[model samples]
Target: MVTRTARHGSDDESGDADYGHLQLTALDGWRGFVAEMHTAPNLLPTAVWTGLAEDKRDYYDDDRIDHHSRLLVVQTPTIRQVIASGRRLVQLNRNAHSGRCGLMVSGPAGTGKTTALTQLGKTVEVIHRRRHPHAADDIPLVYITIAPAATPKMIAMEFARFFDLPISRRANITDIADAVCGVSRDARVTLVAVDELHNLNTRTRTRAGADASDTLKYFSERTPATCTYAGTSLERTGLLSGTRGEQIAGRFEHGPHRSVQPGPTMDRAHRRLGRQSATTPAPAWITARARPLPAQAHPRK
Candidate 1:
């Protein structure tokens, strides 16, 4: 499945693709990130021949180095499954009142948990756009991270900030919550991703922690969006401990993540990397091309 020879779409031919970082939590930022996309670059020329200018050859070398450094994301099954499930859940929860289901993605580092989380958001936004082409102002999704040692008001402020709704310094939790819910409803948002949720483990046992959990519960109940929480090893973190934990566990559908194992998936990933290295005439090849040849170097051949 690693098509090293495959060329990407004509859109990428421009080579000015803008997938730059946008303030993902903000409405404009989220839309900007979703609208701008990038895919794998076409395979660079493999052989050095006569007549291709040195500057152009150097350009090819530079392009390959830049892309390889960033690396390509293999579209694994787990990521595809999560994107599909998240899309379905949003539609399923659109009309539900209470007991609306949510998603939980948990694993250790390097598992691509956050990557899958954002891909789901992108998929949801794309589908929404197809359905409502004229609704340019419809935000459809909001993403934010859970701050450590965060209180009830602090939690409310996170959501409010995403909408860029100015919150007065004297505002209460109620004031902020009202603004977030109202703006999200108007934007017709149906999905929300909250990352770094494992940070909540520290606040799980205290009054502030309990209230923080309650604050999230209240928002989920009030907001129509299908919420998703992604973190690392949630079961071990005490995030799902006690009454608050029980509430979250009961409402959320737990999905376990798998690390890459020794198999075709691993083999394919390795092959792709090797193919990329060979195709671009990797750094070693570039250096050899630059250095002088010895007396033994064949000229007649």
Candidate 2:
């Protein structure tokens, strides 16, 4: 049986009627109208699309993947560091009974924090699949996007979907938290990535006092999974300076940055005041007025 709830809004020419007033046939007609609005004219189906629209959109779509690949090209060092840290966490989890760690990857936008975390999760999943090909599928990682309007219950529900856990609408915050912890414990998930953490403060107004530091600490304390907070530098500092920030900081081990050399197409010698080594490539970009030079011209004297 279908249940309908009337939302507060302006009524049409017809007097306001409870949404439940629509008969099955009328509901079908309404569904057809919506389908016509969204579908391409030439491809419209004879039957109407009657499915309920989903609120959560998949974050890792094809476009997202392409964007991430380009991000990796520009932020190779950060990507490498994130991958290495994730691998270290996986190894630690395998070695310890109470495997818990935390990482805060902070940088400006377009710096590849989300992309790095996504890559890390994929790497862990690949390793897990190779190790236990025959066993039942286990969730090796969980990724959640925190928004400003996010509540503890909403976060729990998102985690529930990720783990394919059955969650009733009546489920409380504690219940959802328990489900998440339970899944991590049973599935041996290596890490949990929380993206857009800055959104957390915006989403949960009531839980504004809920210190991210404390929540993260409690999560790590109760689960064997490492928690990675990927967001802006400001968000990272806020979390790190929060009540349980020290605990969070202690769990993570930071990696060093690596310098990248420009490609062969670019020339560095003319750009530099002093003579340069033949082996070193030029910077990626050059001014439009600069003249192109032969590779032999860059040879060491």
Candidate 3:
């Protein structure tokens, strides 16, 4: 997402620092964002915050929010698995000729599909940065989101936008696709990520989805990258069902980022809780802290 720098008035009292317009799809923006992600925000404890004067807390409060935001995404097991599989695949497909195997992360929305996928890219990108610290032009990852009702040209343009390729108004889909593919190849981009894959609905009769699929296929084949995707119920969307879908699925490894998992029933859980609470004795520390309430303070409910 692109955000404009906050415009502060001359008379404004709060002087919050502005981290301007972070759009990570582009190279400069992405590099800045990665740096930002690495720089964890420092927040003081509640006692320190309470001691601070109200007039000087705006900046500190903002910092606290930043710290909390960074902590929101916990690295779950599934994300770890995705990162492992993606790294392995990129290495596995490095010397492949064509029809390279890919990774697809699918589950319901809000299941960290985007998070897992982006983390995969960051993991690889970090390794590349560490290996070739001086190679600034060696961008090893590309991430783009599929817009709603996106066409083949639209998908190609997202790639062009990420690489910041110069595209004229009269340029056709082939022009954009070729430019993107050439830049990706030149940049030695090894991980190509497409988020919001659910937006590219191939069920439509206009053949736009099919064409979009072809555009993606072209990228996977033309550019030396492991194409990874994240979306909601991709199999149910019929994205991996048709002739092309079957071929794509045949070469792809599917991973589920499911939010729901089978576990002990609620009744069993309640009984377990009851048993623990009824039989367990209070700790000495808790007993020491407790005080008997007056009769007026504890009228029977």
What TM-score does each of the candidates earn? 0.74, 0.57, 0.78
lDDT of each: 0.76, 0.55, 0.77
| Candidate 3 backbone clash number | 0
Ranking according to lDDT, highest score first: 3, 1, 2
Name the lDDT value of residue 109 in candidate 1.
76
Pairs clashing within candidate 3: none
TM-score of 2: 0.57
In model 1, the runs with Cα more than 4 Å from the true position are 1-22, 39-63, 69-71, 202-205, 263-301
Query: Which sequence of candidate numbers ranks them by TM-score, best first?
Result: 3, 1, 2
The residue-by-residue lDDT of candidate 3 on 152-269, one tens digit each, is: 8888889999888889979998888888888887899999999999887887633877878888888888898999998998887778887988998899999988542333533454
Candidate with best TM-score: 3
Better of 2 and 3 by lDDT: 3
